[model samples]
Target: MSAAPALASLQALFARAVVAGEDEAVLAHLAGDPETARRRLGLYRRAILANQAGALRAAFPVVARLVGEGFFDEAARRYGEASPPARADLNRHGESFPAFLSGYPHAASMPWLADVARLEWAAHESLMAADEAPLDFDALARVEAAGQPCLRFRLHPSLRLVRSAWPVLAIWEANQPGRDGTPDREEGADDVLAWREAGRLRYALLAPREAAFVEALARGETLAEAAGEGEPWDFGTMLGRLAGAGLLCAFSRGAAAPP
Candidate 1:
């Protein structure tokens, strides 16, 4: 085999050894004592899995709390085995954990568990999103009235919307540390908004009309279309709230795009 291909093959085998616990194939390529190499590979495998599990634990603390640490650890191990890290940064791992839990037979009893995980993931993403300057309301006011309807808006980069058939917001709040793990009312749907502000994570349940309006905007709908989603509702008040909370980041007229 060519030198480059042979080296790439060796690297792939080593990765499988450490990530998939497949040691036998890679053992033949080792230069040192076979037994020693096997032992070292085993140690590396365990460390990699441990680091992955730690990342999952940090990102899904509420999930860890819902399912005890023992169960969470096993689940994290299975997740790593099935879908090993594709990137070096552990912080970006476990994005599909909520989907994994959805089909997890052991968690069938708690159908809403996946939704809660989704909420947590949204919060994690929001916290990691890039910072942005707040919307320029003065520039917006100067736009001619004729151009208002065609104006598209940009929500904060840190904003995330989560909708679930279960009362996920209530469940997430109830599970917070030192709080009793009981939701005030547990039998309804929830539309939630999670975002980061001033270096802190904040989330709240959004009213139905408000959720629809914000969602329309997030989809890049113009102001007129977004307003239509919440007809008869006071959009001026809603816009004010968004600005006050640092949610609206920018806007554009017609085909012009926000930076």
Candidate 2:
């Protein structure tokens, strides 16, 4: 093998060892006494594990708080090993943490934990999403109200809806700062809508029909088409809710056309 590829492989192996939380056979390639190599690799492993766990904690504060700091620390360490960041940006890590929790035997006691993590991830993603212009009410008004059903809408790029079978939104809200009571150990189901508006990220729980409307709009359906999808539908109320949240940030005839 060429020197460059060999060095690259070694670097990858080093990272793998740290992520695995054990096995430092790669250290054999480095120049040092055996004892010194063991000491250095052990310290390196601990530091790397700690750093990755810290990043995970930062990204999933609610999860940490829910599980308690010590439990989270050990779990995060194992998670870092099993699902290490695939990208250089640590902020992009923890995408699979919810899945990890869902399968972890220890987390089985908190079956709704994964759903809560999903909600947090959506919020985190929205906060980091790119900026965009708000929907132009003037342009939308130009279209005849009758023709509005044919008008396709584009949600803000930062908009995300997290639908869960568990009452994840309630759980998340209950854990927010300033709440004085312990959250109930019960599960409920709903959808969470998250979006960035005017440099601020916000989230709200959506009613069943409302979630369907938002989903339809996100899928590029016309206002009329989306409204038709729900019974007892009120286009006025739907538009009002969307506009109030500033979640409807873009819509154009071209983007709405069947591709």
Question: TM-score: which candidate is best?
Answer: 1
lDDT of 1 by residue, 1-259 (tens): 1233477788998998997778888888777798999999999988987899999999998889989999999999988877778899988898998999998888899999999999999999999999998977899889999998898888999999899999998888888999878888968799999998899998878787788888988888887888884337787677777788899889998965565
User: After best superposition, candidate 2 residue 209: deviation in angstroms?
Assistant: 0.5
Cα-based lDDT for every prediction: 0.87, 0.77
- Tens digits of per-residue lDDT for model 2, 1-259: 1233377888887776665644455666667686787677778888877777888888788888889989898888777767877788888778898898888889999888988888888888898987876677887778866666677777777889988888787777777778642666455677888888777878887877788888888898876777764355666786787787776776766444433
Off by over 4 Å in 2: 1-5, 21-24, 178-181, 184-187, 254-259
Tell me the spans in candidate 1 whose CA falls farther than 4 Å from its real position. Answer: 1-5, 31-36, 144-146, 229-231, 255-257
Task: Write down the TM-score of every candidate.
Answer: 0.89, 0.86
Cα RMSDs of all predictions? Answer: 2.8, 3.2
Each model's backbone clash number: 0, 3
Evaluated at residue 126, the lDDT of candidate 2 is 90
Model 2 TM: 0.86
